[model samples]
Target chain A: MIDPVLHAWGWEIPVYLFLGGMVAGFMIISGYFTLKGHHKHSDFSSFYLPHISLFFLSAGMFALFLDLEYKVHVWRFYTTFKFTSPMSWGAWILLVVYPMLLLNTLVSIPKSFRNRISIFDRISDVINRYPALVKNIGAANMVVGAVLGMYTGVLLSALAARPLWNSAMLWILFLTSGLSSAAALVHLISPDKTEREVSAKADNGFLIFELLVIVLFLVGLVTSTRAHKQAADLLLTGPYAPVFWGFVILAGIVLPLIIQLLAVNHKIRHTPVAPLFVIAGGLLLRFVIVAAGQASVIP
Target chain B: MSSRYAMVIDTAKCVGCMDCVVACKTENNVPEGYNRDWIVQDVRGTWPTLHMEIRSERCNQCDEPPCVETCPTGASHVHDRGGVVLVTKELCVGCKACIAACPYDARFIHPDGYADKCTFCIHRVEQGLDPACVAVCPTRCMTFGDINDPNSQVAKLLTSRKWHTLKAEAGTKPSVYYLT
Candidate 1:
């Protein structure tokens, strides 16, 4: 029946989780900017990045679909709501993402862009008539974004069998990492000088916090049962160590973090390499956790 | 009281012949390279102080089955008949959440894309027959009955013997018990 860990989830899941986390990160950043009225000056937050989230989300969903053994039964996720089921909650949460995205897009874009589409023009006119509602939508985006980010990690921790993922710290680590990675992307692409510095500063803080969370995560496992200790070893000294320590930690976290910190302090100029490393590290974080968690046994 | 089925295996008597496995495969039409039940030989201690415990294991049919709880769809559910966990093939997306949630490792994916596992032979049980595994167990080490009934053989064995369930710390409250 169980065959130990089953190891059913593979690369597709990690890729999907990574993209989902990134998409959540984008939502939070866009939402924060919209609320602060920074959207008026920031093209990346208002027009481009939010729309790019849609494309990334679609790609993630496609990867998820590919992993399903019974693709036709995918619709069954909506047939009923199992409150205890994280997958059920994740499916419904994903549904909310699209409408929230489109609605926010209608209100956040510049007048010139909205004027290009007649339908968008009418919708934005109706939506813009109430600035209060627009503000509320901005807040909703951040709330939903936080939930999405948490869901990516919560689903794994919910599986008590896998000791590697059975920690409350996992979701916090994921959320911080998501935010930091989003900030890195913003810093890399945003044209506005003020916005670029603000995001880079935020990223510096997030990276430091993320590193702390990662330590707490490992500590949580090592201090628990022997089963959990062995699970931690999968990342620490086992087969997954090279990638977890080498790619995700050293290259992904430490390298980019040092670069971003220097850039944030104005000691050095921002380079594309650091942001690229942050994004790549964010993705590898998911893959290593998913794979290592699958390899962990209950016994 | 509602019927609560359970399995009690006497590890002291079991020889790990795996008759229960073959019978289960054949009776349930289980595909090759998969099983609903199997034997586990746990060897503890070192060289001269070795202690081997051979027991037949299957789905714990936990009262708090995480497989059913974590199932994205309602595919993995408990049967009303005796709280037996079963999956509806049509509803399973095979996302493998149930597979990961279960610590007992009592489930496997059917090549047909459904989460397949020991069903306690509910069909045969309904006909007043034991599960295929229990019936074919060569040592007669396996006992099957409703643990809810205080007078049932399983309940009596569990009450009288030194028995333990796998992953007792997991809080799954498994229905299967092993008597040492």
Candidate 2:
């Protein structure tokens, strides 16, 4: 029967959110780069984007698997996709997004037809048959990536059980966080001058958006209609307090903001440290927010 | 013929003995570490002001089944004959999406690594027998019947008593009703 209490969640749920955030973040950043013409004739696009997308997607899938009671049976999700469930949406997103990313990876091989027939010819000639199609597919992947990023927020926000996460603002917050973290990771791994400049602008835009969303999220928490105010208390002083303040607020918000400010002001070089710090902050932010949202300590 | 079957539970008579829980596990041959159905007991405060209540929670077998809708490969589907939700293990790719989608935590991963949950004992019902839980409930707190049939025990109870479903706000429209 309907009870006058919140439904308790398992630890795996939070981890699932965290991983999803990361994957979405990476996909967004990668998409942003593609939009800005980062995936031109450079071998970097061929080598990095697909591989990284696969890594993040696989990581999120693994986290989802770990969240299950019978994790080994997780494959059943592939065999089973229900339209009414958010889990189904996520699975569908993965199914579409991952293959698109893989396609980008496959076409990167210059000689696709040769690879198919020549087993030895790594770059076959078949991809040339559909160059226009391949490019369109690349663009599609970016769009899919952006949608994937937003869906993570929608996933949690759709769960009415946890009032703290039940806001449309979550979609914006998660998407911003995802893109910011993705840019941060890119800045850390590759120091390409052109990519770095573009990433910097994207980072600035994302950081500003995230800061606003965080404020709005907190406002929602404080002014909740029900016992949701407890979530605010949890964020401020409960088990998630240290995480919220330390990682989300301090490292994620403050540190990144500071680094961006210094870089914009010419006070600091665009060194690896700043972006690395931002990446760390972003990852930590996801971890804490996810944890905080799932924790229910109403007595 | 299509039928909307249901379970009616009388929480007032439940003694928290977990007999139904055990019976469900044994009847379904549920995995040792996992339970397709179980009881959740909430007791507030210490001795003096303490209030105790036990809820036998399982897959609500909602009319709008989220698990079935989320199954990408059609592994989980509603049986049109009895409106019972069933999971086809052979078709299941083992994706835990259904588990996450189900708000009740009713679904669990089976030993064979497929999703499984309470099926309302369709097999037993086909044999003209009550569900194992209904047969084994020492307090007779649980009842199963065709809500469509006015003469069914569940129909009588629904007409006579106030009942509720868990997480009704989720729009799952669960068939299982509880009288607290």
Candidate 3:
């Protein structure tokens, strides 16, 4: 007795996927920043990281709010928490991550100091008292982000109504796609100097992973039972043919591969635009997959 | 006024004329190309061994309705009487959280863009009339009554017959029961 409402396409799911992809990218960017010794770099964390994270986080929250049937009910999601639901997990993550990113930003401000001591230092001292709380919050956020990154695929796979999406690979594909999109996004958004170099390598690594995942995904689509096969055929040669081949395969995957190849050959650094293309391609792939999965008939 | 109304359906008697579907639409003034309630035929297995089952499902008007709980705007709500789950389209911002939470796809957004679903013809029921679906059914497949009343037809039937509801796994505790 799957809900009919879940079957249809609304704008919000794609929007969430897009934002989720970006967030994944930001996580990698933050990781890169930490690894590259940029954690101590003055302008990197102080000016750029906080503002960018806030901008995306706020926009993600806005998109989340817009996806709900009852927008006001979202407030209680935080106030009255449910530890069981994935949505609750996502809500708790946003709750901690948004504030931490913001506070981490504010504390970096030189003016936010008590004499030689920064306000963040004071805030950290207070939070450090609740060591369990801080650890739980970080753990919850990473778990939530990881889950949220892959749940979009699960949303489709949960439907027994759609055979093509019912595969176990759905989650893996989603995870890889999300990681690829995220890496590409970081490449697009970060400063063009050192961060760009860090993201470039990450992008290359993820692109290889994306390609492998796509191959496995295609193999599963082709080798499944008759119902799934027909559904896959619909995407391959039926009404959704052009969208499946054109947007998803060509522009989204191939074009970026070509751009990256050219960048490597020219001895020129990959521009932010190259990675942005990959992110856009990933988003387009999710969109097409979602829509096509719905349009597929069970015959 | 603390009255919870629900329908008990006899699936064996239902020929699937879909009178309930049409009746629900007309009575609710359901928008064109949208249904408040519908009969879905679940066909499973391959040829020569295929099985077909018809379920006339709408809002089950659950005792613990997830749609009501998950709604961020309180647009989707339950009526105190009959436990009818009603959506206030006027209040709905159309975020679709209710859609995802509902294990039964009893709710749909009409083309005009508001949440729409079967109301059990509350207006007529308020006037002491049977819902349009029950009244119009030639085979009397649908039985409407207050399950709380010992004398009600629903209560008697529940005691005597084997019954089931769609997606009992959802734990929605649907008021609509099916005696197949």
- Chain B TM-scores across candidates: 0.98, 0.93, 0.90
**Cα misplacement distance, residue A218 of candidate 2 (Å):** 4.0
lDDT of 2 by residue, A1-299 (tens): 22212123445555556556666666555544444444555434443756776886677677666655445555656654455566667877888877666656655443323336464233323543555665565577678877887887877676554556667788888888877877776666664665666676678788888888888887887787544688777777888888778877777767777887777667887777767766677667666666666553222
**Segments in model 3 whose C-alpha atoms lie over 4 Å from true places:** A1-7, A41-47, A67-79, A82-85, A103-148, A151-171, A217-234, A261-273, A296-299, B1-19, B25-33, B39-94, B100-105, B110-116, B119-131, B143-180
Query: Candidate 2 lDDT (Cα, whole model)?
Result: 0.70
Candidate rank order under TM-score: 1, 2, 3
- Tell me how many residue pairs clash in candidate 1: 6
Best by lDDT: 1
**Model 2 residue A200 CA deviation in Å:** 2.3
Docking class of 3: incorrect
* DockQ (0 to 1) for model 3: 0.18
The regions of model 1 sitting more than 4 angstroms off are A1-7, A110-112
Better of 1 and 2 by DockQ: 1
Tens-place lDDT digits, model 3, residues A74-155: 5555554443344545556666566545544433343434356556567756754564544443344345546656655665
- Please write out the lDDT profile of model 1 over residues B1-180, one tens digit for every residue: 999999999999999888888898899999878888888889999999999999788889999999999998999999998899999999999898999898887888888888989899999999999999899887899999999999999999988999999999888999999998
Clashing pairs in 1: A1-B105, A1-B106, A1-B107, A2-B105, A2-B106, A2-B107
TM-score of each: 0.97, 0.79, 0.68
lDDT of 2 by residue, B107-170 (tens): 6667566677888888898898888888899999999988888888998999999888887877
Question: Tens digits of per-residue lDDT for model 1 on A1-299?
Answer: 11322437988999988888888888998888777777767667856777888998899999999998888888999999999999999999999998877877876667558568789878877877888877877788889989999999999999998899999999898888888888888888888888888888888888889999999999999999999999999999999999999999999989988998888788999888998999999999999999999889778
